[model samples]
Target: MTATCLLPLFETSYVAGEGPDRFYAWPDALILPQKVRGFYVGFLTYTYHKGGFYLLEGWFSWFIVIWTVILLGLMSIGGYFMFRKFLKRLPKEDGMSILDWEEHYINETRHLWDEEQKQLLDELVSPVPELFRDVAKSKIAGKIGELALEEKASKITEDLIIKGYIVATPKRDHKFLIKKLNEKQIDYSRYQSLLAK
Candidate 1:
């Protein structure tokens, strides 16, 4: 804790503000000792040590120590709140695993297929062994979700039909063109024309 005297016993000044000059003066100078305690009690004593005239003096005063302590406390509180605000502004981890994110994407797009379409899809993959059909369907659904999320295509039932995952029933007039599932690969040619528009 550092201390500074707050009282100036003698002060002289000249002022010229919108008028003739004005002069002010005080004849005596009060000097405080190099050390004092509890000066903020609002009263303190000093001594006039000028011209070899040693005279004790008393005056009202509030020291700088009190103001310094008050300012430091306010600054500390402000700093704490600022640090908290900075922490809140930082980005937070999402805590979602990749598989969880993929499942969430799948769930969001599941409704794109109508009830009839879903039933047809179920029937299409039914030829796989019962134990493996669910796994195959899940893999297919994951692929579909991936494509949809990439904005390449949304409805994959036609792709599956083209790929022969869904057996095409014979039509009376039109011959169905089917490629075997083993030969299936994602063909973006169909979407290229749509995206060009």
Candidate 2:
């Protein structure tokens, strides 16, 4: 013997003078659940009511019941197969799970690494040997992190230098000018005449 359950997906009720006047005149249908021969059955009760009193009540025609059963069965089967397929597509433990790596590493440093940098690091570390991949990836990520920090530091330094020059601070301005001249390979002799003035 098998036990079945009745689950109501939708239902609505209206008391006399509590609902819209249109609902009172409209024919109402009640879908009730029944257990028969170990299977749950849906019985539709069509009722005609006037002034909050039922004038007539009868079961739905056989054609409607047959069609409803067919549709429900198809929907149930389709939902079951879809759920199975979704389960099969989930990440499995075979040692090549990106989700595992992401959960372990990326989730922690998400704020530090942007999508582009992460993609670049992945591209750089992908061709490495499997034994060294994790180490290589970590090294690459660390290097990228250091580079970003250095870039921000240099920008701050440059801004400070510019502000110093704007304020006519001789020491900082002279140091930056000298650095620029050295980078351009310009001889100090070229600026000696201006300095002499």
Best candidate, TM-score-wise? 1
**Residue 121, candidate 2: alpha-carbon lDDT:** 44
lDDT of 2 by residue, 1-197 (tens): 32222223124443334333323323352322455797654453233333333211233344556677899999999899678646644676775343354344433444665465455445434545786677545543433333335455422222322222223223333454456546646455544443333
Candidate 1 residues 7-58, lDDT tens each? Answer: 4422232332323222122233333333337432332322223222222232
Clashing residue pairs in candidate 2 are none
Q: Which stretches of candidate 1 lie over 4 Å from their true place?
A: 1-102, 152-157, 160-197
TM-score of each: 0.30, 0.25
Poorest stretch of ten by lDDT in candidate 1: 172-181
Give Cα distance to truth, residue 80, candidate 2, Å. Answer: 1.7
lDDT of 1: 0.46
- What's the count of clashing pairs in each model shown? 0, 0
- Judged by lDDT, which candidate is best? 1
Model 2: CA > 4 A from native: 1-42, 51-60, 95-197
